[model samples]
Target: MPFLKTAKLSAIAVAVVLSGCSFKEDRNDIVVPIIDAQPAQSSKLQFPQETQQKTKTVPTYSYTVRSGDTLGIIAQKYLGSSQRYTEILALNELKSSDAIYVGQKLQLPTKGLKQPDELQSSNSNKKSSDIEPNKTYPELNELVDSQQYNQAIQWILNQPELSNNVELQEQLVELALTQSKIYKRQQQVADAETLLSGLISEAPLTQNNQKALISELSTLKAEQELITAKRFADQSKFDESYDILLVAWQQVGQPLENNILFTTTRNKVSEHYHQKALRHYRSQELESALVYWKKILAVNPNDDLALVYQDRVKALQNKLENL
Candidate 1:
């Protein structure tokens, strides 16, 4: 019994040492790491609150076109440059700058920021005193006084400096008058009238004796209209010629025979209107033909050709109605 007990005690000591060695091997060879649920440092991906942006709303407004309000003038008032008139055209969906009429409503584009070059151009335009007109006007005046009309016109057009100078503007109108008179003498009536009319159109409100000048220009213009109308009638451009005479006659209060030139042109256009009516009649366009015949009778009830054509068209219209 004592030897059996000794053997049991020795086996128990050996088992305990084996278990200790197994624990030591686990400690030396295998490892488990501790993990954290939260980060140690703040994230670099986070943006500052101030860096966030909100959407912006664009602004818009409406405008009305008053009399004498050109696109350039409007642009100058609002956008700061006459050159920016094209921007207004795009905003309004207008095909041409000339399409706007008095009392027309235009959509104003007020949001666009001015480009650097455009701002510079606006500044340059506002500072036209940079060009000393005193140095330039004497030579231009000499060209006018000497009757070098073409040269004077070319010089005036080329110099943007002369635009706002009241003294130079008056001289320009006088030069234009001289040019028109010279053109009339040369029988270049179209050129004469155009120059005079353009001058009157652009003349500023502050000028002296502007009404008298306009009256003189109007008389000359009426005479040129008659001359051009006669030329058109001779070329068989009857409708175009008559249209010119019609405008002149209306301007002069639509008198029957106030001036010999007007009377002559009226009679000539009356015959032409009758001819145009006959042409329309030959093409079986009796209704259309009656329009020109009526115009002829309106100008002169005594027109024999117009009376005949008018009667013929009315009879044809009656026949068609009966059928």
Candidate 2:
């Protein structure tokens, strides 16, 4: 019986050793209890209000009113429809469509609106120095189609890659021409001329493009002079009007000089000045009369009426001085 007890004790020791090996084989199972004991104390400590406060605010977008930015154009650019300009009017509490001015900051709708960087990234495979012309052209055309000429010009100028883009250079020239015509139509002659001149100086225009821009500039100047002369003549400032017309005639050449509007305006101004000269001559204001006659001759150097009147004025002056 003692021998049997000794054998049973030996069996118990073997079982304990085997159990330790099993535990060693399943060592990974011990980690669960340790993990459970240390429950996420930090998560429990987090306040709901603090968590809410940490949540990000919905972002908004805005645009600044640049030169030549109309509500329709702005809406087309930012909101994707020119017709949505009314939304801008409502948002800004603007009573008139004409109320927005350059440098005004306007908040844009967030929906469907992307930041400029996001637009640049998603629209084109752009590198630091190069851009995908195909993708970029459509974006530029949108601004052009909206008649946002100045903004389009600014956009093109800001793109450094456009400098080497021959197609874009040509497009810029065409866009400038179109914008100049619009400015001329609006009677903003100076603006039209300045826009052309600036593009001529800044753009890498082809020879033909340069010629076209220069020609347009000349025509614009002539048209402006004619308008100013007509306005002065209407105001009865005949001498000033005649002087302006004379300058325009001398400056412009060929078809422009022979333009019907210019010719008609010049004749009207000259005749008005002639009538004033006649009045001065009859009133014995010889110096004033001579001044008008001489100006008329300066414009036409071969005017029979002006030459005859000028001679008569000089002869009369001599006679008066002798007397």
Q: Give lDDT tens digits, candidate 2, residues 1-323.
A: 99987775455445434433221222222221100122223454222453323322445466766654556556556777544655655555443312344455566667666445424555357332222233557878777667677887788877777667767766677677778878877878888988999988887667877787888788788876787877887887877887787777666643453466665666666676677777765454568878877776565443434554565556554543444
- How many clashes would you count in candidate 1? 0
**What is the C-alpha local distance difference test score of each model?**
0.55, 0.60
Which 10 residues in a row give candidate 1 its minimum summed lDDT?
A: 31-40
Worst 10 residues of 2 by lDDT: 27-36
TM-score of predicted structure 1? 0.30
Which residue pairs in candidate 1 collide?
none
Mark the regions of model 1 whose C-alpha exceeds 4 Å error after superposition. 1-220, 253-256, 298-304
